[model samples]
Target chain A: MIILIDDNPIDTFIQTKALELGGYRGRIEAFRSAEKALDYFQGISTSAIEADSFILLDIRIPSMNGFEFLDALQRLDKEVVSTFPVYFLSSSLDLEDRQRANTYPNVVGFLEKPLTRHVVAGLPGIRKAAS
Target chain B: MQISIFARKSDFQEVTHIKGLLKEWSPKVFQYGETARVGKLTREIVILYKPQLTEELIRIAAEVRILSPSCYLLVIGEGIPGMTLFHAQVNCALQLSEIGRIPELIHELKARAERITSDGGSMAMQELQEKNKELEKINFELDRFVYSASHDLRSPLTSVLGLLYLLREEVKAEGAQRYVSLMEESILKLDNIIRDIVAYSRNNRAGLQIEEIQLPELISDVEPGLRYLETGEITVSGCVKVKAAFPFSSDRNRLVTILNNLISNSIKYRHPARLPEIELNLERNGQHIVLVVSDNGIGIKEYHLEKIFDMFYRTSDHSTGSGLGLYIVRETIKKLGGTVRVESAVNQGTKFTITLPLAYA
Candidate 1:
């Protein structure tokens, strides 16, 4: 399962295309807001979220940003947050952002924009699926 | 050299004695009840120390310092045992017994006044330098703000462009295709404007890196981008003659930015009936390199000639430009120790002559 969180619909669409092109046949879920994604996570049982599930999160968004969402998720269930691999997908090429993203224990990678098929395939645990 | 004394009304007798001794000086006296009125004065300050109201005296002294930092604070009272700390904060602390020696006190006051005047001038200068540093920091932050703002704006536009690319393949209807192409054009225009803004901010933030620039190659690099934006053939003349003096020393990026903006502007505001023509001429003039970009486009009005290089000053309401192109061009030119001037008539043509110092000083 892949959970994509980006406020922009066009970004989400592009990411979906990129993911499909990268040959990921799993279920893909998208939320325009971090709050909505949190709500979706809260409604589901901890065990329902697979260990292989990936979260592609954008850092900048209205109300609850990517870091705030991660903080909220940690409070909800630290075990569940630790289980899934999270990747910060941001348009910002700021070094501060990359350093901050790296501080998160579950954050697998910090990827720049236009999330291409090659970038999707390069994710740590998803490499086998891409191959 | 006006001196004002502040003290409790109960200490009036002591204050009066001091005033009578220095009768020639005519010091203004303020009762503790008139502390609020003390703030209105713009004279050298004197606080008559009352041991009973030590806290109040310190507070008033602090207030006076705020009102005028250079205002000399003269403390006149018996030197109380624990008042050394309080005395340290003031310009001069004097004993009542010292008041009887008028000539000595006046000499000390004269010396203190001179010290305060000199110290105040330096302090004010230091404050101005600190303020200038703070303003420079704020200007840098503003540049960063423009960079981030344009970056964020570009993100959404990138998404729109991506979606449009996908939609071109999915949408088979002729009308839908036409709409998609129009949407693409608008998005591209917006993208270019955002790029220009980001480039402008980057120019302000980044330091100059002087390098040798190949004239024909630089023009060719800018040509494709402008050609992509225009519908008609852009006939670029005078590149061959300029290419021989191939390597001109300057900040290449800024020079390219100036040329790009001028070329883009020429393409953007081209006269509908006339095919767009841009003439480029570069010549070595004394210690400077003179580059002229003359375009037969919809020229500026006579009144707008002065304001065309000002930020956000667009001539026509129908124009879709961000109004930052010319301003950025002029600014970048200025940063490179260059000067740009424009000449235009409404229906005729516009010519911009830029003279850049050959070396980065």
Candidate 2:
């Protein structure tokens, strides 16, 4: 499963298309804000998340930012939190932002914006065998 | 100079003796009992220490210190040591026999007043320093604003570029394909200009962040970003050669900016008759690192070579760039305490030789 959290609708739409074009055949979930995503994560059961599920979070967002959301996620059951890894997909080229993102143990990678076919193909657990 | 004296009525004879010595200063005498009514002290105040009024003297001295922090306080007499006198905010004190030092003390005070007045007063210096601090704060705020503003600006441009690529892929008609490609080119040009603007501001505002830089990694990182610059039948490529006798450490961001601009410019002005190529050579040259970026492209004329690094100075009428690329490169080089020299010939090529300090202190 692929989870995308971005405030821009155009970016979300492009990401969804990029994923589809890159041959990602799985459940794709997207949220327009970090708050909404956190709410959904809180409501879901531990069993609902598969081993392949991961999050693509944006750093800049309204109300609750990516870092604040990560702080909130720490309060969830450790088992559920440990089940999936997170990656940052942002437009920021700031070195400080990349270093800060690395401090989060769950963040596996940092990708620049306008997610392309090349970037999607590099993601883990999104590709499945032909039906 | 004006001196204010606070003393007991019984010490009138001693006060008169002290008054005779300090005749140079018009001393204003006040009763010790009227300490509470001492209103708005501006100049020097002398307190005649009496053993019984020790507590009162300490309290009044502290009050004066707090009310007028710049006011000088002098306590003259026995019973209280100099260390204890300082705790009560007393500037200095002297015994009855040491009364001869009064003029010397007054002379020192007069000199201090003159120094303050000559330097436009300590108050003025404080105000000037405060204004400088405020300006530094504003400059910091403005740098942050530009950083975030550029990020905000680039986000939408990338979105459009992505959509344009998607559109180009799905469009089947040749005419529509051509139109999509044209729009893509226009958008990419706009994106380049925006990127240049960000680089210019960043070079002007951001401080140098030194890091260990592998020559091959830096060159490879820059090449992929400019992949789109190659189109049609023209093939633009870069060849890098490194002769590193030792480790090289410098500002990574600034190095990236310099390389990106130079390589992009080489591609932008590629020779139409041949496959354009960018050649980068990095070598250690005695306490410094020298990088040479040479290219076989449409080289600048002699008249235009000197003006190329000037801000917003375009080399030719056909140039479509923001004209800030070379300017930013020059500025970034200057900031790193590096020097850049250009040598070129019309229709043949251009070469830029840059020398930077190995370790920037």
Candidate 3:
């Protein structure tokens, strides 16, 4: 399962299309807000999830930003949090943002948008699932 | 100002008449030869002098003048020795009939002191007002720039990049691949232009924050961004040399922007036949820090060099840049209270020599 978190509905659609083109046949959950994504995470039972999941979080979101979402996510159950690896997928060209994202332990890597086929093929969770 | 009436006991009636006129002025009506109050008199002492013992009174007035340089001794009686009056720093010698002029003189002196104090305060206030107006103008321009950058610049770029990604995925024909690459190049050029616009706006909006600048670190920080193009095209990868020995102080951000633009330009316009080589040299020359950026790149024509720093002025027909890079460099250097000069030979090299004040204004 792939969880795409972005405020822009267009970017979410593009990311979904890119992921499908990259040969990933799986459930994809998209959210326009970080709060809704957090709600989805809280609803899920860790043991009930069978597949590997990952998140592509956007940095500049309305209300709660990417860093704020990371802080909120840490308050959740550690077992549930550890179930999926999070990666920052932002359009920001700021070097400071990359440095800041690296400081988060749960963050797998930082990728610049728009997520292309090449970027999708290198995902840790997707590659692990395929193998 | 303290007013003291020093009159002899024989002139009791004259002293009473003087006191009645100066009651509102709060004159400290002291009798002649009152040595006790003389020591305390300081800062604009006004003495109403009717000297009977002329020598003794002159000596006392001189002592007061020594203590309070601004003391004014106004003599009212006659036989005032001219040399003694000069030694005592007597401001005015008035006859008994001219006693009414006392109030007017005191009023004039007070007005003058007030004017001096207010002059300094008002000058500072005027400067503050001018600064406030300047800040307001900058803030307004910043707001307009941000609005346009979002609506007119980045929004369109975002849509195009996203659409291009989707288009690249859907279409994979042999002949159409070239068109797709061409479109990508144009989009990348637009993106760079937008980036430059943002930098330009930032330069105008922000004030100079002076700090110690390490040229080597600043150069390295600017290097990574220019090396790899956003469209997956690797441009000129040049060898850079730095020779900065002395500690330099300037606006760090502005310096970074200046160096970034210059170095990137060097890399962009590099000669295809030879390896790209760039050098940065910094040294103290008198009261100025001289910075030279020399590059072994495709140099500009003599006439083109003069017009290169103008806004939106592209020199070459093949140039794909925003034409804002050199303009920004010149403006930033100017803001640092510096001058920039260029020397170039076509297909050989280009060099920019910048002279900046050691202590930035």
Clashes of each: 0, 0, 0
Clashes of 2: 0
Look at candidate 1 and tell me the lDDT of residue B78. 29
- Which lDDT tens digits does candidate 1 get at residues A99-118? 57778888877665656555
Worst lDDT run of 10 residues, candidate 3 chain B, spans B76-85
Error (Å) of candidate 2 at residue A45 is 4.8
Per residue, candidate 1 scores C-alpha lDDT tens digits across B1-361 of 4556666777788778766766666777777666566445544446443523444555544322221221234443222221222333444434455555543555565565456445564554465578999999998788667757766877877677667756765788999999999998898778777767676776777788888888876775454334335332343332212423447888766776888888878777778788767777888888999888888888888888899899988878446778888899989998998999999876678999999997776
Listed per prediction, chain B TM-scores read 0.56, 0.60, 0.56
Question: lDDT per residue, candidate 3, A8-126, as tens digits?
Answer: 88888888987887677788999999999988878887775656778999987889988898888888866767536888876564545666887888887776666766557667667
What are the per-residue Cα lDDT tens digits for candidate 3 across B58-94?
5544333311222235432222222222223334545
Any runs in candidate 1 off by more than 4 Å, and if so which?
Answer: A1-131, B1-149, B165-178, B220-245, B345-348
How many angstroms is residue B174 displaced in model 3 relative to the true structure, after the best TM-score fit?
4.2
lDDT of 3 at B117: 43
By the TM-score metric, which is better: model 1 or model 2? 2
Determine the backbone clash count of candidate 3.
Answer: 0
Task: Please list the residue runs of candidate 3 whose C-alpha ends up more than 4 Å from where it truly belongs after superposition.
Answer: A1-4, A13-30, A40-57, A67-131, B1-148, B165-170, B212-249, B273-292, B355-361
How far does residue B79 in candidate 3 sit from its true spot (Å)? 46
Question: lDDT tens string, model 2, A1-131?
Answer: 77999999999888888888777878889999888887888888887887678898888877888888888887766567644688888766555666688788888877767777655765666654212
